[model samples]
Target: MMTIKNSPASQPMLSMTGFAATESRFTGGLLLIELRAVNHRYLELNVKIDDNLRQFEAQVRELLQSRLGRGKVECRINLKSDAAVANLTLNPEMVGQIAQTLAALQQHFPQAQPVNLVEVLKLPGVCQTESIDTEAMAQSLLNGLSQAIDELIAARQREGEKLKQVLLDRLQGVREQISIVKPLLPALISQYQDKLTTKLREAMQAEDDRVRQEIVLYAQRIDVDEELARLNAHIVEMDRILTAGGTMGKKLDFLMQEMNREANTLGSKSVAIETTQVSMQLKVLIEQMREQIQNIE
Candidate 1:
């Protein structure tokens, strides 16, 4: 089981896709497996095989589905050489065709290579012979395919690791912005209160009591304390999932959206410039994570 801690890039990147395969052989046995994959909305697969190997399609599909979660994949199997030929094959049809053609050419060019049985047999399609041991080929292909599939999985895991690091870095950035905005909250509330008081003083020059009541009601309606608390809670959930490991892509994606929602709400409340900046930074980090989650399996 490969994990996200193995990529070299150390960043959240969602564009990687890879493929690999291998094979092995045994007595009267042949197997070739090819694996292909790419990022997509969900895990999808298509398995293709030569007409003779149609029986193996289900087996290959099951093998892939059990291990992968979120990519479009294709698998194919075929015999690289004809097994029916056994040790030697001769094409009578080709021999006849070539012999006649060569005789016609000799009429015009006397010096042309004379028609010869050995030469005709050596030509393409004239003789199909092999020392190929089908058992050995099959076993070798099965072993090769197993290795290739493992290679493909490794490639995907390496890419996933990079994505995880990138997300962590972005999360740290969001935390820093949150810290910058956190201390400003008390001062921000006081400043808004002061501005309200000033406005009330000018508007109610004739009557001060009426203006004070309006200012208090305005402050309560615009409060963003609840939104900030939820934002913090979402961040905790994200960290927990990352640390626990395993298939958490879908869960992480949902949490990212929730984080963005909180940020949006905080921004709309608009208590101060620092808070607004923090909200924007949170959204940016969430967006980056969302893109990378699509590639996780």
Candidate 2:
């Protein structure tokens, strides 16, 4: 009846990468279990164990998949038997055959040294050790795994908290850039209209209604109000997701893509040096958040 500890009211985020290990000693052997995880598009599990513990593979995979949502997880089990449990026992038939062969060799070469007990035992198939209790070993390994998962989750949570703060800071920077760009829009449009009118008058040597229509069309092309509004909305959504925690890597990644799209549009439509600078800064912040979000879970 093992259960994961409940998350606190202020839920912290979780990173996909972490490490944990646990060990248990039984009457016959020592069992060591280690878990390592890193970011992946989906849950990918790999387990390694000594032949004696191979029977527990399904159970271990089930336990890991139930606990983790997304990551490339690697599980390793090392079993070391005690001296008493590993003590070799003679295979009577194999030992008898080896003894007969050694006697034949001694008769052929009288000067050869007599075969010792150690030499006979060293011969393949002459000695063996008893098998371990697979059922008992599986139980012990699972118990150790339960504790290891708990520690791994804790480590991920700690790293996630730091990632959350970094994203939030970048989000705030995006907001600041949006604000800066918003004020410059009106002035940019006015300057473009004035410049267009002057150029048209100089080229045509007279006022023309067609010149005014062209200015309007050019102004509309550079208007970034829609992009700014969408950028602001994306920032709000990102903040909400971070606050609500748990398996947010994919969601955050999508949001970064949306934010980057808006930033790109803003840069392309820039009419002034200040607007271009703000767009560049916004892109830099979004890129930073995107990189960090890749490691979140």
Candidate 3:
């Protein structure tokens, strides 16, 4: 089954490969979001964010799906507290708790080594960073993601333009190959009839009617006009799809298969070395275009 990779109708063809990263500062921390996309049959998303920001993963996925139509996308988010605002301050409550616990311990073992103030301060929860506002952080995260996605789509657009040119050149090559073979058909048939007539004359001096019938059969077997016509039609459709420029990956792929089938038929009916060469050239061009189309979205 073929899968269509959809892109915006108003936009040019897009390649499903790009990379973008954005960083922004919020109330208490800085947020960094990075997005990378590669070709895929469908839109697949993998989002990785800090444990504290896991709550926003669903939101990130939704945002990406809204902006992108197709690709395997990987998103990474990192949030770090600002050095100036995040300075660790002593926890007065924790300190008081520690003092009360120490006094209780001393009552039982008064002779034990006195608790070191430096060591006590090093204990967990003894120091804490300023709390961040979740709402503000979420806003910052979304904003950064939006920017990164914009950059990624722009990169894909540039890559898509290059791919479009490559496909166009391959299509032109296919036309050239078809041109080379069309003129050879009549001459090839004539040569075949002459060779058959010569053989028949040497063997038994066959009647003219019999020889003509044999020539007609040979011509019918090797005729490739139908194949050529189909090939031309497929080429025209491909060109139209490329020009229209939206969700064409699957359509172009299907056309490539059809063109390849016709080329195979042309090769099988080859009456001359020139026709065989043309068939091979056509296959090569079609394969090249198919390879490029795989990356299109």
Provide TM-scores for the models: 0.71, 0.86, 0.87
What is the full ranking by lDDT, best candidate first?
3, 2, 1
Question: Which residue ranges in model 3 land beyond 4 Å of their true spot?
Answer: 1-10, 92-126
lDDT string, candidate 1, 1-297, tens digits: 867675443323233377776654444445666788887768788877776455555656666777676778887776555456445678888877876877788888998765667766677787766555644654465455567667877887777778778878888887786677667766766787677778767876635466556656766656776877887788788877776656677788788888888888878877667777777887887888888777776
C-alpha RMSD (angstroms) for model 1: 7.8
Task: Tell me which of candidates 2 and 3 scores higher on lDDT.
Answer: 3
Q: How close is candidate 2 to the true structure, as a TM-score?
A: 0.86
On TM-score, the leading prediction is 3
| Model 3, position 175: C-alpha lDDT score | 90
Q: Write down the TM-score for model 3.
A: 0.87
Ranked by TM-score from best down, the candidates are 3, 2, 1
Task: List residue ranges in candidate 2 displaced over 4 A.
Answer: 1-11, 84-88, 101-131, 205-212
Per-model CA lDDT versus the true structure: 0.70, 0.86, 0.91
Q: Summarize candidate 2's per-residue lDDT along 1-297 as a digit string, tens digits.
A: 999998666567999889998887776799888989998889899989878788888888889889888888898988888878877688999988987887888889999876678777788898888776767777788888888888888888888999988988888898988889887877877887788878878888656687778878877988898998898898888888888888889999999999999999999998789988998999899999999998898
